[model samples]
Target: MPQVYIVYMGAQHASRYPTYELHLNLLTEIPVNCSPSESLVSSYQRSFSGFAAKLSIDEADKLSKREGIISVFRSKTLKLRTTRTWDFLNFSHSVNRNPPLKSDIIIGMLNYGIWPESKSLIRDWDLRQRNPVANIQKSEAVFDSEAPLVTSFSSRGPNLITPDILKPDISAPGIDILAAWSRVASVSNLPNDTRVVNYNIISGTSMACPHVTGAAAYVKSFHQNWSPAAIMSALMTTAKPMYPSAGQDQLSYGAGQLNPAKAVDPGLVYDAGASDYVQMLCDSGYNETMIRIVTGDSSSCSSSTSIGTARDLNHPSMALHVQSGKAFAAKFLRTVTNVGSARRSKYKAEVRADRRLNVVVNPSKLRFLELNEKRRFTVSVSGGPLPGNSTAPATVIWSDGKHLVRSVMVVYTDFSS
Candidate 1:
């Protein structure tokens, strides 16, 4: 007999009932044999096929990371496997132990799962099994009306020791999404072959991660030679901020929704190399030993890693809030490489200051860099020299003659010394 591996993919909670039922229906459609092993294998294939039918490759990748889904496959008979349960603790530990893998197709899934510590406070009160009256009371106890409901569900920062910064280097759609499911799962109440719909929506950083992953896949499919970092840079440079939803904060969406078409041909990408990240840590005040520990080069230490003075244009340490007042100055240096044509052209750097703060650009014009050549730029901010504490954001937009090239955020804070 040959080895077989089955993996399940998608969010774990029964809330994804529609998707589960779809997978079950797929299992029923597969041909069965007398052998139990073969039958089980058939069932797994049917279930995965059902999921694949409903999702693009990118969506499937996102599903694999969620608690309930199995993310990898290894079976002699199967060419590609899906939906085996993942060991997240082991997976996290393994990433620390090994270097990154080299592959032709690298699919990056970004989900902002709530901080494990914050889960108790923000667990969904509306889950079906909870007593409705009791849950309503509990909701009032846990959250205030002004507090955005779904914002906390986004993934957290200080991704400890992951090779790449754990944050959503970019954002996408992972929220109350409707897709395929398994019919046989007891939790799914829908009939097989029926396309069940989960109309109630969900929002979290998870909802946002897949949108960018799909875009990355699209870019990889087209530009097969690009590195993972390059692909990430392209997506970030070209991402758009989500328009203000009825009751959402800008922080929740980061740069906003993703535009894959724009990402594929970004006029210029803000590239960050390994050394750049190292320098960022150093500028932010980390010693060599501390840098090694934070970047996963060494074991954990007692003293906190210092984030000194320098801030990367894209560093996660800085955040701007509309109401808080704190005065600060930060600089971000970026190297922009033009992958396009060599013709010299004029490029302007524009800053779209949020209403709460004033921003000034030192050298607003960017000189042309030849194709394959790189250029560096710097930005600085002060919180309007106000009397009280306040904060706002400057959307630093870089543009060529035709379209906006890239936009990075400079968050301002006004805190008294």
Candidate 2:
């Protein structure tokens, strides 16, 4: 059966080459005879170079093997994870605002919905399509006392794609979020329902995403030159740690709740550039060609590596999964760049783990003379054969009196894997 498949070719290398023609040429090269032009669904040339086309599973597999092609996978139906947002995060309106610079940061995401004549998805309304909103009532909003608890819908991980890397780097307000609504679309999305409202409450990963995006932009407003990784580190390091409860494991809330105020001054950040990620992919067993498909870079991986390979990424969090019935020992190397306000800072490492897990950090103390000064450390986690479907949570905190840079670590023993 034919299905729409998206071909990923990474970032475009040159402007002169027409991506549409390139996509067609690849299609024509398929063993089966077919009109390449007719198969083309659309060319994604604006941001990155790729194309969508209707193809069978075999054709997609064949296309994935093509040169310059990074990946070819069938496009699946997307489920919108829906958000109470700001106040719950303790980021109230009273917080500092830097709108002029904040406006410059663009978070490009597809919150795809009906695009009315006006571009704003939020309050710029078109009442012509529905009954006029009755009133503009102003009132104090009620709060969810148990605000930051993990919703059942949130994704859990010892990341399947790359188990070494923890998924959901962080969490944000994503339940019962009152965001703007499209007047033309039914509020309940029911065919017979004709009700339309200016705003509607929602919950999901999508809602959580915007909350984090806004926090990132907020963090950017303060540190205009911070990289995505740096900003992420700030957020993760300064986050309020969450404890696992029933129905929740260590992987659940990532680096915990999104704390916008504290993120601005993370003190130390595990800054990573493209090369670091490239190295991570390399460690994850991706070849040179596969690396280019994802990164559009020619960086090569060497055999000389740290205690751990993919797990060594200068990431804000660390995770490791082992067989439930087998004894496991793993070491991870991490580097942190001082982004603190103080010119000279001293940090001490603190590791907290379960009785069943023995965790140690090498060079438990670090000293930095100036901003951007980097320090590297290694964490060794060793434990006995744990029972199946179990997890042990641990924390590594690097603190310098004023700032607490925390990294969450989890060791899972999953026989099912």
Candidate 3:
């Protein structure tokens, strides 16, 4: 099947001809503000308005109808009269109608800077609406909790209300990540193209999500039977929360960071099947008809919803969010698949709270699976005095029996209280 790529077009490049030349110049002038100045705001409005005026309504509608095209513009406050009313809805419907091309995978390319827009949609869909059909419960619980707060930098959820849930089910490392860029696109385009190899550092959960996606691809290549839901479960349950050291403010590092190896071998993963999401929607007040509409099946309700089980609540994405708070503590979980054999491993956690809060894993070990087998684990803030509001540096450490696998910084701030 033809691969479908979904790229977010932030305000910087919302126009049709989003050339790098224009983007760079715009970047230089646009001030980073919650509410931009009138002149700048007006300029943006004029630019998009002009762009909209140039296109015939049909053409604009057609562009919006393209598969994988969704609104990634930030600030619901912005007046995107034409695009929001029709263009966006058209795009959403088109993607919903078309099945993925017979490709081995679907890749979604997102820019972290586009998060504000993404989150706006999610917040509205997941939190605001009642009788919603998407998995808003998980997101809602996470949003209310203090843990990481869904990386203020990442986009929010409640992607769409009907015809298959489309919220961001999980997160990945899309912040300050080093990735390859196209030299032709980076260098040949106007200003500041000095770097070779076309490599650049971009941040956002967008960077993080791709890491998980790539790992999922690897898993799929080996195990084709595993469904997308399974892959998502594995990734979500296996994530780690990285925090800053004492005397620091909460930084962007969330869930400690992504661990591909550990994720691949997580012992237990919080799974969310289709019915689980359906039930979550139901709990949020959706009825059978709403579920059918959201799941693209208006026929009879599936039996999965009839047999209520606690397993349905197993969602690591929600779990981590519920556990970790903003009080200078970080927590995350890992997921692993059962390759062939099941092994038991002893896992231990230790916390060092002082000038900085440090968590270390002891015996750094798990015993399961053969040479190529995998298992999952969860690391959390088991014990620690909540940090004061004053900014401080914090540290998180993960160690295996023989080696220190990773360390992350947790930044703190005293602004709120």
TM-score of 2: 0.72
Encode model 3's per-residue lDDT on 1-417: one tens digit a residue: 111111233334344653433423332343322211211221222122211112223333443454433532222333222212112111122221123322466545544323333433456345566665654222111121333234443553322232112235444435345455554453322233344553555555555655666667654554456666666555544555434443222233333444444444444434446766666666445668877887997544355655432222434432111112343344444443333224433333333444544444333455554433455554444334444443333333333343232222233332342
What are the per-residue Cα lDDT tens digits for candidate 1 across 1-417? 223334455343343455445454433344222232222332222213323223334333444454545553443342322211112001121222112222456574544432323313335334445565542221111223332233534653323333122233555545444322222232222223233332323344444555556567766775676666677767766766544455333434555546666666766666666666676566555676887877876533234544433445344223432223335554554566665544575678887776645566657876774665667766665554433433244576667866576554535223354
Candidate 2 global lDDT: 0.80
Candidate 3 or 2, higher TM-score:
2
What's the lDDT for all of these models?
0.48, 0.80, 0.39
- List where candidate 2 sits over 4 angstroms from the true fold: 1-84, 92-100, 110-135, 183-186, 191-198, 297-308, 415-417
Best of the candidates, lDDT: 2
Candidate 1: segments with Cα more than 4 A from true spot: 1-103, 108-169, 179-207, 243-246, 284-310, 313-326, 385-391, 410-417
TM-score of 3: 0.38
Ranking by lDDT: 2, 1, 3
Q: Pick the candidate with the highest TM-score.
A: 2
Write candidate 2's Cα lDDT for 66-157 as tens digits: 88899888888854432235555667576565667656676555554324443344365555557666475455556555656887667778
